[model samples]
Target: MSTTRTRARIATILAGLLVAALFAAPTAAPAAADPTTRHRPSPPHVVGTATVPVYSYADAIRESVWVETPADSDGDGVRDRVAVDVVRPREAAAAGVRVPVIMDASPYYLCCGRGNESELKTYDAAGVIAKAPLFYDNYFVPRGYAFVAVDLAGTARSTGCEDVGGPAEVGSATAVVDWLNGRARAYTADGRRVSAAWSTGRVGMIGKSWDGSVANGVAATGVPGLATIVPISAISSWYDYMRYNGVRRAADYPGYLHSYVNGRGEQACADVLARLRADSAEETGDRNGFWAQRDYRPLAGRVRASVFVAHGVNDLNVTTNQFARWWQELAEQGVPRKLWLYQAGHEDPFDVRRGAWVDTLHRWFDYWLQGLRNGVMDEPRVDLETALGTWTTQRDWPAPGTRDVRVALGAGDGVTGTLGGRGAQPGRERAYVDESLSEDALVAEPGTGGSGRLVFLSGALTAPLRISGSPSVRLRIRVDRPTTELTARLVDYGTAERIRYDSSEGVRTLATESCWGASTAADDACYRDTEEITAVTDHAVLTRGWLDAAHHRSLRFTTPLRPDVWYTVTVPLNAYDAVVPAGHVLGLVLGQSDPDFTEIDDRDATVRVDLGRSELVLPVTGRAGLPSVAVAPSVVTAPAERSSARTAPDNRQVP
Candidate 1:
């Protein structure tokens, strides 16, 4: 049977099996003969501790306290109490060892508020709360180290006016670190000395999300004694998070700000939410003003700590693009940095894959803070592509061995398969409607479904295709009218299913052509006549682009600009995992538009997909074997001749 027919048959059988399983379940279960016989097993032991050690600072070991501090250090206005959660090895005292200190500056207003205090108090009184200072304390603290969790100024017991992401926040963190270093030698009125002079003062900083961003922000100050930083899913730019792709994301801004400022309380959040809502993009668009004052990019080169950054590929709320941009910029500036990309949405680091993430962070911390020979630095960088169920390692970000293979689109007899076939050549092109899609039109849904929008399949591979590097698609075409939107997606086609890998989009404004090329302006008539009088330059037109397909794109090409004539747009495909399985195909999908992504539409358009003119270029590396495989054995036996001979003799005697 043909591959298509075989696939259809397998799909049918699978559907039938699913339907049968749904109905075949037992309606009722047999009751136990005796209720006492079915006694439930006792739950796992719930380890409880009064105080957990978070981290060990230079001379002293900082710890988490169920008790509160009596005095406020800074006299900036707010009276407060403070407590530090310390984590350290039990053998530290006996070994006279000094572990690295990792201080956590808790987010004000959200965590460690009055309600949080009440909850912590209740848990403490009940003797059930664990007070390790590390973010993932239950997982990291026990491995021989110390962690400190501090309530920022104006929250918990810390004093001073609350300054979110400002210098005051940094000061508060530094103050805690200072306090920790003197813990063993400091004296109270009663003459009790507190300090950890035995400790070696190696300190590090780590935070997740808000904490992560603050850590990055604080690291920019070039604070002394700060060793390393591991910022995960951090917000580097506030403007980028609130406003994406030049569009204001009104829905998320207010709610997010309110949640952070008010601690989810109506009274506290009302004023902040109102102020944020009233803010205008025009007033803050330029990063050189107040926004620039808040940016950490300026401090990128100054951050002395060894940094490890991790972000999810499918993080919708905090898109990975910003992190990618930061990584690229840092790399260009020669900053010591490492990055991990995992297949996950927002909160991916907190999921089952969190261990590996934490492990990576721990390795970095150990190497920089403790000076351990854990071989973490020796390991190749890891890229976890969950969709393909594979973990790839490379020496560099983009890896190596990427080949650009362009597959041209062609007009065929509606039979979907590989690109090579007898179809329209160079000069021949076909046109299709570019109106709003009808309800019945086959369109991709949001999120994962967007992968189905445009489809191209590669021929079955005799060997596993290893692809490691950036991929790009080049399309040469023209729309029936002026402005049109285009979306392209790359897919890994299995023997049975097509899985989306990556995608990008571009908007072409054809009519506004200057002497140089096409422009973004809507009015073409005004500029068409003065083409010669006014010098037309590349700046007046928009050209080849790279966008998240969900986002925007540029101008300039040595090739002439075409109006009704065919024009080519080249889009970069984000780096992805290679090693496509043998007998499976790779697919490239191109469409006029994708509704899931907001595209800039400027014309009442009729568009055509010029197959002969359009091509999907793939960067194919050398082949690799399947990562793993399993097989079963068969059995055989001889016949029993004696039994047959006895039966024949008996029959003859009866006859």
Candidate 2:
């Protein structure tokens, strides 16, 4: 090699070494606190810029208490009590150094379990907490932070009926916050009243799924002392959880879920279960007083604590709409917020990106709960996983330059249709039958005549087209029956390996283990390793929407359609973020009663579509990159003619 090349290479190596050495060096201790600012001085037990293990984890104090709530869910003329298990640093309490809290209130503490390993909380012989399930206690406790675990009311040892996400369930968390702030009552196991004198009255609630949901609910109540919350793949509305656009997705789920999570077999909760079933209104799948009471979006203005939200883009169980809708409201309310959107489905960030997740969380808590002068809030507002192991940061979600673009549908030779800059010619029509078919059948043979579905295809793109938000489909159609289930899917047709987010939440656990922080014999911070699951497919459904035709105009009531009368209806698809490759075609498949997602009975009605009045509206990013006529060439062709060089073992994404 030339001397110049060798010298340049040596300089690069030296620069990398210098960077590594700077990071390996220890940070200087924080300076004296300023009383006028929010920054607080580090206590004797805490000794780090952000936070580190300076205290003993094994010697942390372990205790349990019962917090009284104002809800009489069991209706025995008494208020309900929520069970709380707490672990904190012994040195902080001994030295009278009150510290903030990191709490996880969950119903799964005793039943169904938590996290990827499904670990449950354990107790010692003296009835004190022996082991808390996650790494929060073992790691944060040694960093001078207390980790409190609470079994939500109606589950485990708590005395109340499980009301799903109703007032009783929400009260379970708010009451605990109230007690920590010295505004409510709490008692020890021996019946002696106690106060949270050792606490600074600042709390940060963090959890996944149902546990995270409770955090959202409590934060919405505008409770004081709640410094911040980290809700991972959580639900914001119970109505959206069980239904979508007036279509029941999980029918009779409230009562079934209550029974599944309640481990105590208390007969008093029987009436609560009956009430849940009765108020669900499964017959009409309409939003009623029951769902209104459980929704947190309307109360977004009341939130006082900052929020750090994380959710999966492909989550089908709690679904992405839950977070999208809630995030929009939080933005409108001008709440201090941050977001992390992953490519996986219904999974926690701990399993997806453990090391980074832990480090980021530590800084977030230090800034919000400990009042540290950490620059975590000044960082980017959104962290999105674009693909497996590939991430990008943005100032906000839905990308910076996202806008809705209307792509019209054109007529195909009665079998297939075209999607382009303009709608089909006047009087053109396409028809289908209600057969409750799988997506595979609905999207198959798009170039030829098919049964049970109508297919529209955009020409293979010349440039990568990125969609950043929800898409909606508008159609003018007539059904032979009063009402029928309508399913619309936005699909990407090309051969590319993608994360199988729908399959097992996009992760598979390995036998190897990794440790996060200090550990003891009773409680360890080690967890099994996990890897993302991916597959090569010819076509993948980007997002889908389902609607009950009769309730399209109003989710609260139904309007029966007259036979052969054309009525325009809109189907709002789920939120999604993805980029389709240049050679890939964007397809729209319209059918009735999707067997994979909806469980409604099939009406077996014939339906006809007016092609000239149908269109697809997509939230496209970088409008200049995709011009008005750039979506696809103004050409009508079968999907088969577009490409035959690609193949996949599974053929397609199920939904």
TM-score of each: 0.55, 0.90
For model 1, the superposed segments whose C-alpha errors exceed 4 Å read 1-98, 104-135, 138-144, 150-201, 207-213, 233-244, 247-261, 264-299, 311-317, 338-362, 383-392, 403-455, 469-487, 495-575, 590-620, 623-655
Question: What's model 1's TM-score?
Answer: 0.55
For model 2, how does the per-residue alpha-carbon lDDT over 126-163 read when each residue is reduced to its tens digit?
88888889889988988888888988889998998888
Question: What is the clash count of model 1?
Answer: 37
Global CA lDDT computed for model 1: 0.44
TM-score of 2: 0.90
Tens-digit lDDT track of model 1 for 338-445: 767655434334332434655666666665655454566667755555332346666656455555655565543333323433334776554544332321122222
